[model samples]
Target: MTETFVHPRAEYIDTRQPPPPPQPPPPGLAPPTSPPYITSGTEECESRWEAGAAMTEWEEKEVEEEEEEEEEEEEENS
Candidate 1:
């Protein structure tokens, strides 16, 4: 004949109940409307490059104008 024994302090968990739902954020805080950052596309890169080139041309023109004005002032003072 064989004999079986069980532990007296073992506990059993109930699996019938569902887990609790997630909590919502407090007042005055809202979710983001858009992503934190964006990955530039080919069109966007081209546009940015064109803008930079235009700005460089504008700055060169401004420098030339300032140099011409300085030369005029020097001629007037001579």
Candidate 2:
């Protein structure tokens, strides 16, 4: 390696869904009795491909508009 310094460059990313609607806390939710996030066996993979998912311009615009309308409605009600 010519230079030993490591650098990172970031890029902007957009999602298809309008960050899923937040759910209100349940009056009384039960806790799971078992442990979670324990993967028995798995393989290292090219996770980057997921971010490359395709989204048409129309779909993106539709979601953006829907989100905006929802925000406007909430603001008016509040």
Candidate 3:
């Protein structure tokens, strides 16, 4: 009797019910819309990010070239 009491309980797994459907928003308030200004701002941000990324890539290549030149100079001196 004690072993059966301690065994897994199927009733616990069967008890859960699906959630009810969501209620609609109230009638008076209109659904939110993205304003033109907001979209324009987003586009500006995207362009700026692209430009910044390109600049960073160019800078990295420049740095690598400088390092290579320095290494060549050291080798020539040695």
**Which candidate wins on lDDT?**
3
**Which of the predicted structures, 2 or 3, would earn the higher TM-score when compared with the native?**
2
- Candidate 2 segments exceeding 4 Å error: 1-53
TM-scores for all candidates?
0.31, 0.32, 0.30
Candidate 2 least-lDDT 10 residues? 40-49
Model 1 bad stretches (over 4 Å)? 1-55
The digit string of per-residue lDDT tens for model 1 on 34-64 reads 4446564434445566777444566557657
lDDT of 3 by residue, 1-78 (tens): 355565556556666788989777689967656564665543555555677744356655765787999999999999
Tens digit per residue, CA lDDT, model 2, 1-78: 598664553444554677878676677966543355534311111222245755567656765787999999999999
TM-score of 3: 0.30
Alpha-carbon deviation at 15 in model 2, angstroms: 48
Model 2 clash pairs are none
**In order, how many clashes per candidate?**
0, 0, 0
Evaluate all candidate structures by whole-model CA lDDT and list the values in order.
Answer: 0.64, 0.57, 0.67
Error of 2 at 76 (Å): 0.7
Q: Each model's RMSD to truth, in Å?
A: 17.5, 21.9, 14.6
